[model samples]
Target: MAKAYRKDEFEFFQNQVGKIDQRVKSYLEVAGFEKWTWVYAPVNRGRMMTSNLAECINGKLKQARELLIIEFLEEVSASSTHIYSIYDEGKKYIVCLDRSPFSCGRFQLDEITCERAITVLKNKHVVDMKPYCSEYYYPEILRKTYDQSMFPMPYKKEWIVPQEVIDEVVLPPKYKRQPGRPKKNRHKK
Candidate 1:
């Protein structure tokens, strides 16, 4: 019902749900049709349903999540018009050069071509990887980023400060450490 794009389609699903449980149908009705049904939603959610991105990312990070930060970053950080099937040690993988996502998930996460994508590109005789790499890695962008001149700071004694500003008192924040082992990983936003 939430994915139903048309009123009739939504109604069909609603009817089916009603047949299964009248209480659920009543609850859905009380919750407002527009809130849960796509056909009546005022805002366009594109093709992505709620939690779709989160679920997809969670699925992708399943293996990488156990890795160290450096390895995780490396893993997180594809292809052509056709899909390619790749096999490694009896394990089969899929790669598509034209699509943004590969089955490995590295290409999508890092915005860079993964090894599988690279193999496909090599097979296609695509030598230049600049097109596949993120623009942040571009030489022009790098040069532009560091083109501005930087000046060295003067000694503390040579710095000028207002009398009123110097008199201001700033105290450290109060913190109580919680019992248990401290976390090694940085806190995420």
Candidate 2:
């Protein structure tokens, strides 16, 4: 039902639900078909519906996560030691169409844009930029992010305040309290 983008396909799934299990039809009647429609949800949770991917990653990093943060970082760095720029080895980039890094788990960050950029760069016989990428796999953006200083709270004597900005008075919002006893938890309707 979630993958059903068309009306007919959606209806077909709805009808099929009743055929599979009578109890499911009753549940659907109570919950509504919109509940099963992923497209209607606020967030687009792509195709995956299980924790199999996480389990696979956890299986790979089973020993690493058990180590200390510094050790973990070292393990990660050691694991990707083989990943390097072609220039490092005194070699030029190869623009082979068959050398796509699809399903490499690196393209999931900025799906369409990154994939398109990679493909375009590969076609143009540019450098292999797969390695040396961090934090969303965009080095320029990552560098720019680290370049800025996170300003911490300064001493009161060092603080500078505009008189007009501080002088302006603001009133707290006014509200009337409800008469009924408040419910503890908000139950979904």
Candidate 3:
């Protein structure tokens, strides 16, 4: 389960596990057996798709964790202090109401919410920025995303698997030998 699971392999594992215990299958069903990829929930997860992140953090914080609680907290705070500094410098933005989607390279969150957009708006004397940003970035959208309910899946015995899909044949791509002789030197565009 620690390894990155391919869809076909995961399905095979599910089928094998299904033959073992129904209770275990039920538990896995509730835990998103098919959709358990690490990238599914990326909020503040540091893009960690494996235990490598924990290993790296453990290594860096090992000495710090051994220190007194206050000292450890201070050390952690000191280590992350640099994140408060903004490195975006000499970047430009073209802010316009007519432009359907305004974009600035510096900000990942959104262009309209970035400092450059604010500066442009201030220069143009435009107030109330809610109209400038897309509705997709609105607070309501985030709230809705969090509010949705995802029901647990049924047990493996109850799972619906079509016979055609389960027995489908998959083949590797056909290899073709090029007519031209292989070049030793790399070609430049």
How should the candidates be ordered by TM-score, best one leading? 1, 3, 2
Which is the winner by TM-score between candidate 1 and candidate 2? 1
lDDT of 1 at 158: 94
**Model 2 regions lying over 4 Å from their true place:** 1-137, 186-189
In terms of lDDT, which candidate is strongest?
1
Q: What RMSD does model 1 have?
A: 19.1
Candidate 1: tens digits of C-alpha lDDT, residues 1-189: 886644666889999999999999999999998787656776544322232234445555678889998888776661113566788667566765543345554454345676877888899999888877677778899899999999998999998999999999999999999999997987889
Q: Model 3: per-residue lDDT, tens digit, 1-189?
A: 322223344556667777898788788779874355422333322221232323434545678988999999887776542112223465333432333122332222232355655666666687877765656667888788889789999998999999998899999999998999987997889
Poorly placed runs, candidate 3 (over 4 Å): 1-92, 98-114, 122-127, 169-189
Candidate topping TM-score: 1
Q: What is candidate 2's lDDT per residue for 34-140, written digit by digit as tens?
A: 56764344343432222233343444467998899999988767654322223313433321122222232223222222344365566566696644232454767
lDDT of 3 at 79: 52
Ten consecutive residues with minimal summed lDDT in candidate 2?
A: 93-102
lDDT, each prediction: 0.68, 0.51, 0.52
> Which residue pairs in model 3 clash with each other?
none
lDDT score of residue 91 within candidate 3 = 37
